[model samples]
Target: MPTPSAPSAPVADGGLFCELYWGTSLAEAWSYGPELGQVHAAPDETAPLPLYGFTLPEEPFLLAERTPRGWRIHVPPSARVEKSLKGDAFHPVGPEELTGAPGRAAVELREGMTLRLVEGELRLLVQPSVVKERAGRFRVRDVAWLITVAILFLSAPVAFLTMGPDPARLAANNARALQVAHDKEEARRKAMGLDQPLKPLTEAERATQKQDGGARVNVPASFGVR
Candidate 1:
């Protein structure tokens, strides 16, 4: 078994690989091809597996090799395999239980199938790189959303200018508002007795009031005199 080391970059050959999921969350992923031959988990102090949280066996217990037909995983006594055929429910089985071989305990992994290791504390989702690559490519819906965003961005200024109030009308509105405010202030001053308006008497009323020989002869009707 090969000692666990830092995972290398993915190859462009679009080969099948296993995705390592720690419970419900994906932890790490490893790719395998004919060039690398096989992959395994063996303890190495210099460069340990990048996985965190859980510890793997100090010795090589889990091994995956590229077979002629597909990738085959060998299950040791310390670990048990749980295979999911429909991706929703899983069925637990011994390594030899699937192969029906008493001595050898190995099974080939298929695409879209999930495998769970009881002792390993992780699940493996089998898929090909081509599928992942295709999924990463932009779809029609993504392009349409981008177009909609661009249209909104480019049309923002136009919409604001079109829907905005006219400058001439705004100025007229401001003038009217100032006039109304002045009228209100004047009314408020009068209500508070801070401002008073003088009333001029008519000529006849002013003529009615006179003084004779230092005594008043007639008074204006406004003075409450008959």
Candidate 2:
């Protein structure tokens, strides 16, 4: 006899980072908006944050995990990281005094990077900007293409639903079904010695049969008319 298979493992409810949030040694905080402590010179226009890849100021660093609300960075406790901070002069002063707050000033990790919290905001300092020249009207063309694709994506299902079966084909199928039913009725009638042609209903017969009034007339009442 063959050996039975083992039962599968139970599925987890949330992502790895989220499931481990409480137990993990690192203190975690969620970002409210799209910005993740981005350092921008332009104070008015808060541009979108930079890419994930960044330069670490020191060996001791935090990791940012993407979450539904926003990005979540995990920072190890001050007590756990105190010894490591001694090696770097640029590290936060008096490491033991450090406390993890949900929303405070952005924490500066290094020369080019900083992490801070303000109310519900979480912004990270990124490297200085690098200007890029536009590739001309090609961008406009790409936008147009994307719009066309989106329209097609939406309209495809509507078109499929709106399309109806051919009227001629439907009529032919109905006729075929009616013929089959008539043949079956004729066979039944022949067995009963009543295989005669079906006469058109007279006005009085139609009225008594309730065919004209949309009410089903009693069979005996219709037969009594003749």
Candidate 3:
């Protein structure tokens, strides 16, 4: 089982780094970003190594650093480097190969190039950073929707101001409504015969009428004789 470690640090401005894949498994890898500074490959007894069962030497076998062009791998004399996967043999390097003095030899790794180290136990791949543009130019269709919404918002007040009737027209409508109500009332009175002129009561009929507005009562002459 191969274990992958989280990025040691946040990706910074340089946006360049080297990815070390454990053996042939592409899924198990570690990213050495520029913010990580320098990375040393050495065995630690206290911490469990997640290098897919491969052990590094007691001394630093390899050192990885970020360079102006790309990532540079420093290889000790004891270690050998397989520069390419396309039939290139593992070659021994010395300090003289890079800086022309006595130190660990350095090799610049470009994008898509794989480097094999520690007798082909570890593999490193160089990957470039990808940036996406967040700000985009507005299209005509995008602006058209905004314009339509603004027009709808502005048209509400204009429609409310223009659609209402003027004061004179409102008064005329009220007068027409009152005339209709009066005409309906007159029609109802005529239907019930209440609209006809009343006939005057004679003197005998007036004598029988009640003074308290109650209905007139009539009594027979022999009602209490028995």
Assess candidate 3 and give its lDDT.
Answer: 0.56
| All candidates: TM-score | 0.43, 0.30, 0.34
Residue lDDT tens for model 3, 1-226? 8798854322232334345555666634444434544566544443222333334444444456666555676655444665553345545433344642334467765554456655355554433333212336899999999999999999999998898779899999999999999999999999999999999999878877845587677788767755
The collision pairs in model 2 are 36-123, 36-124, 37-123, 37-124, 38-124, 104-117, 106-115, 106-116, 107-115
lDDT of 1 by residue, 122-200 (tens): 6655543442232357889999999999999999999999999999999999999999999999999999987977679
lDDT of each: 0.61, 0.39, 0.56
Clashes of 3: 0
Residue 184 of candidate 3: its Cα lDDT? 100
Best by lDDT: 1
Can you write out model 2's per-residue Cα lDDT over 134-211, one digit (the tens) per residue?
235658889999999999999998888679577888999999999999999989989998977779999898778875
Query: Which clashing pairs does model 3 show?
Result: none
Candidate 2 residues lying further than 4 Å off, grouped into runs, are 1-142, 161-163, 196-226
Off by over 4 Å in 3: 1-28, 45-62, 85-97, 100-103, 118-226
Task: Write down the RMSD of all candidates, one decimal each.
Answer: 12.7, 19.4, 14.5
